[model samples]
Target: MRRWHALLWLLGLLALAGCTRMDLAYRNLDTLIPWTLDDYLDMNREQKHWFEDRLAEHLRWHCQTQLPGYLPWLDRFEQGVAERSLDDRALRTLTDEAEQAAAAVAVQITPSAVELLQQLNDQQVSDLKVAFAKDIAKRHAEKVAPPLEEQIQKRAGNMIKRLEPWLGDLHPQQLAAVQSWARQLGEHDRIALEARARWQRALLEALAHRREPGFDTRVAQLLQRRDSLWPAAYKEERARSEAAARQLTLELLRLSDADQRGQLIERLQHLRERFASLRCLN
Candidate 1:
């Protein structure tokens, strides 16, 4: 959201900022909407008003329809944690389902995105291209410019930070396992960014043809067919990354103590309750 344009953010809305802030952010969508527009494009006053209104409807649909579905997903995942039965297969299933949820949200908003994009004038389109280039440059600097060892350590640190919220402080073995996992995924960030570059280029090309026939179909394929759109190297890297992550997860769960598992269960339960308590249709 910080880097992408408004439409790009909408297409990738499933990447919530944090595990703990999910409910608060969802409930305050209006306040959060401005982040998507910042430094990305120059939507005029009328266009901004229109997009905001349409975005509201989309969020409402998500709250009322999409979120309920997640409760069950969390249920299954929490059960896996409680039962300590989350092998690689279970992890893969959960990951696949999460991707499907992301696809659903992307597909739902693509029409609105298409409509708004077709309204952009020539100058706005030029600004968008510049913004896209800037986004890639920023990502490259942050992700690819770092030395290999530094990137690996930073990646490990981030993984620990995310897991600590749910798993509590990792002991020596779990910490080592996490670091090993990160080391195994060497150069992953670079691979991911290359795929992102391809995706961004594809979007711009499709946008260039926004006024032509079959433009919507092209955009739809871009958003919904993510794995297909990815370059072959990216696809291979993704598979490797997922396999490594699942193995690391399985190992960590095996190494976790009762207290850590209990903490994880508590976090999942809290998330479920938080989601269920929200009044969506107001």
Candidate 2:
């Protein structure tokens, strides 16, 4: 269920220009996430009720506690854009803040995940393994089977789509720069697939011993300290990819024109208002 953490990034991205879309999606997330989980492990009535109740509690905690915190980050980002003072250090700081916020949420939810996993029957565990295998195979086919050049092109295209909401259309030079950045980003699909397989393998191993003492501690560490479980090679490759991305983002910001800067500030401002509105409704 750590995959559910990706929702935070999605919410952040969509907040820039699609708050209405994000709001609707966020409201339905409790429902949508259960549907996704049911694909992997079908829960019995009691477990389903427990999960729904826990999810509701987590959502309320996130809205009441976490959403308000984003205001300061947005304010800083807006000021940086307005003053043309954004730099790599500032970007790193922002990234760290976001990670900390997500980690807090992960900590809050880890106990619930452990409780639910510990209750899974053998048949459900088998179903989970099947689901993991199916997901890995699908990802390998889609992400790894592509030719290298095609993969780079697709990666750059996806980055453009994400950036365009705040940056608007990229200039020809910017597009070329993005393509170059994509090429230099070390081969990620293979390493990422390996990392996912490794994590799932570890999870299944942990789940199989669910009745053992300290099982909850082990599972909590697995979920929150996941980086420790990554293959060293994968860790290195992922770090390289992330550093390349950060460099690319900083360069893009440095090259942004007045209109692009204004657009970014406006988008951030709009996101601030949206967060405020959501908190007030809470």
Candidate 3:
């Protein structure tokens, strides 16, 4: 019973962590474009929820579950993080452990993603790979277009306008204060808009002049910063959590009878194949 309780607690914690990771990932995805905070926030409540839930579910199933299997040593590393009195070295050790765990999980899961597609017939799998590649290219194109940002901003402005009348019952002073804040925000937004416009113009000018070196370098730097900096912290945290989860899964796998283990392996193989195919396209 105690073990069961511990398992439930771990799962709950994992679910929360998975949700947080999903939110961070989606926010980063949007940030990869020139879109504003308001534009992302202006998504309908249901749409936002769906995005969060979908990614969370995917992470829980693909990342969270498989992580434990690959990195069984994470349990001790995670326990160190939970302790309030851990020193810097201990923390550093935990971070290193997490990095290794996450890398292992990523490597393991990526290949399995390909197997997932194999569960489909050969033709269906081929179609899926093509479709996945096309979708990724479409998303990449959207990210590169400043016009999408402008369109999102325009939609957000319209939403704010539509909401203003509904919020008009406040005191005159309150309304004035709110309007002042809005104006200041709008000014800041305009600066960002101008910057994006300049970037777009520079890209076009670079293209016309065949001056690819500087432009390509700048883009490469931006992408490098994103890859090196942003995900590291989250990756560390995810590694710790996944390590704990992996420990749990190892125990579960151990207790499972041979037939059950076989079934689990088959399912895992399918998931891995699908994920691999997606990565190949990306």
Candidate 4:
């Protein structure tokens, strides 16, 4: 009986190991080039939905599988920050990971688009590359020119404008409270923007130094470090944003009329259900 029980335990351990391996493989596959809105725009309605569903499913799987790996590192970083024990090495390591993760994901996704482009004639592929390059340049300009804080304030102001009509029958005080919440969101956005910029700068710097010997090895090291850090940073930031969202939702619910609140809740629920239904293609 003891031997049988030991055999069962060993089988269970093998099953768990298999599950972890499967999850890691799924993440690696999912992180391979994300399908953008532009990819779906050329498709028929049904095709567009199908593509979106597949894209979302893959992205969700990637997040679920990869994010857990970084949590311990991030928790340590956060704790260090809280305790004022943060060191340059820790910050640099985190920054390096963020840059590498971004690049790795980009590289993974790029092949899919490249494959699609291969099906096109030379001229068509050239045109597509040109268009893509132009978009990238424009984005680069925006990134370089915008003071992260100002850009965030502009976006927050825009969100407030968008939400104003939905905020029904609020007293002056309540309206002011909502505006205050918007300002807080703007502040959060600025922090995120700064973080993104720091990561981008790190990546660019690494690329600039790529002519040195062992460049590929260095690049691999950076990405491996990032793979260890980025997901946890992402999760920490997401949790903070979600907490704010819950707080805002509660405040909005209090200020909104019964009908408006119900309508908002219903709309949110429907959207959530729609998102949940998305699946990635095999």
Tens-place lDDT digits, model 1, residues 1-282: 222322223212221113434434444554323224446787899888888788788778877877787788778877888998887777777677766766677788778777877888888888888987998899889878999899989988887887788788999999899899889999999999988788878977888889999998987887677678988899999888878877887888899899998998897798788778878833
RMSD of 1: 3.6
* Ten contiguous residues with the weakest lDDT in model 3: 1-10
TM-score for candidate 1, residues paired by index: 0.88
Lowest summed lDDT window (length 10), candidate 1: 8-17
Worst 10 residues of 4 by lDDT: 1-10
Candidate 3 wrongly placed segments (more than 4 Å):
1-19, 22-98, 107-117, 147-282
> What TM-score does prediction 4 earn?
0.37
- Preferred candidate (lDDT higher): 3 or 4: 4
* Candidate 3 C-alpha lDDT tens digits along 1-282: 011011112222231132133223333332211211122123346544554554344445544454344233333433333332344444345445544544443343332222221223444434534544554445444433446445446434543343233222333443343343333333333333334344334323333323333544443332222233324444454445445433322333333344543443343344334433442133
Q: 162-242, model 4: which lDDT tens digit per residue? A: 454444345565556556655565445434444444443444454444445555544444433433324455656644654
Ranking by TM-score: 2, 1, 4, 3
lDDT-sorted candidate list, best first: 1, 2, 4, 3
Best by lDDT: 1
Better of 1 and 4 by lDDT: 1
Minimal lDDT window, size 10, model 2: 12-21
Give Cα-based local distance difference scores for all models: 0.74, 0.72, 0.35, 0.43
Candidate 3: deviation at residue 117, Å? 4.3
Give the TM-score of each candidate.
0.88, 0.88, 0.24, 0.37
